[model samples]
Target: MFGRPTDIDCDLWRTDGALLIENAISSDELAGLREAFSRCAEQAKPDWLSGVRAGTRPAAFFDLPDPMGLDDRFLEIVDHPSFYGHLMAFSEGQVIFLSPQFRTVPAAPLSYVGWHYDVHRESTPLHMIGADLSG
Candidate 1:
């Protein structure tokens, strides 16, 4: 009964193009995932960093490469059968994970995409579909 995302979760996503499910991942898993991310951050090359900011102190934040090879413990959340099954129920198996990565963004006012769409204005015509997940 607790395995699948609820109807409310699905409806919220459909309506607002977003959904928040609390405690979906266990605390231990979360800790391990965080540790894995910390390791990734430590190893991330300077060239891998990217953001939109004017000064030396970025208004945005440090970013990692796409699809971080975080431990399978971390990646299992995305590849899990039960989780995928729930997603399929809502999306009719049409969901696409464009870029699944653990990019660490410090908690700054401008660190997020906010209300604006994630793509360039001109590129909107192409109708690129994506899910912008955060942790």
Candidate 2:
């Protein structure tokens, strides 16, 4: 599912508070995930779509905070062998598995999440796992 974690991976996480694991999923898995995402987006609530399409400027991306209910694949990934171990390693075996969110960035010439802070302003450290399905 993923390569074994390295000392460097842990070091990066400790120092920068972020780490990148490349090719974490097989191409076939990626394709399936992309298809699932598209299907869910197509059937998304109008309000969700509207929030994404809102704002004067083109939106950078939109997130479905409660995406686990949208598809079975979303639930399958919670204990997936791919990156769960790495997550545990980074969190010192004190990891809490929150329902993963689904975020989509529409195709645009300049697709970027501009300057802004996340919604929650708590000081508690948070760990995030993100996958780029763009082929």
Candidate 3:
């Protein structure tokens, strides 16, 4: 399956240039993906570094770059058929990996970036575009 994504026949690509396939990730693969995400944030394990020293859910980081590089499981998610298969289709066999990888955790919260724009006029709307690559 890694060789290349087999071409799709629908002519939607001729006009819309996009296609959405629900249930893309197989349940089995999804289980593995969940495992990978759970392991991705190894730092979640408390090491008494934060000021709280010993609190619930310590040192969990999010929006991390290249999290797939942290472990093979994460990397495997990147290689999973569910993710790359559709990517290959959308890219027409010439995908440009602009944003290779990133991840976010629930506890990080939105406030970090929530008031960022309003605080300074110099700030502008920021959007990060990338493939989930989470098989």
Write the number of the candidate with greater TM-score, choosing between 1 and 3.
1
lDDT of each: 0.59, 0.67, 0.53
lDDT per residue for candidate 3 within 68-92, as digits (tens), equals 5666765666656755766666567
Which portions of model 3 miss their true places by more than 4 Å? 2-18, 44-61, 83-85, 105-135
lDDT of 1: 0.59
If scored against the real structure, what TM-score would every candidate get?
Answer: 0.58, 0.61, 0.48
Clashes of each: 0, 0, 0
Better of 2 and 3 by lDDT: 2
Pick out the ten consecutive residues of candidate 2 with the lowest summed lDDT.
122-131
CA RMSD of all predictions: 6.7, 5.8, 7.1
Off by over 4 Å in 1: 1-17, 45-59, 112-135
Q: In candidate 2, residue 5 scores what lDDT?
A: 61
Model 1 lDDT tens row, 1-135? 325668787788789865565666778877987787777767764444423333443334455555346466656777555456667667776978776645555555444434326666544322224345763
Best by lDDT: 2
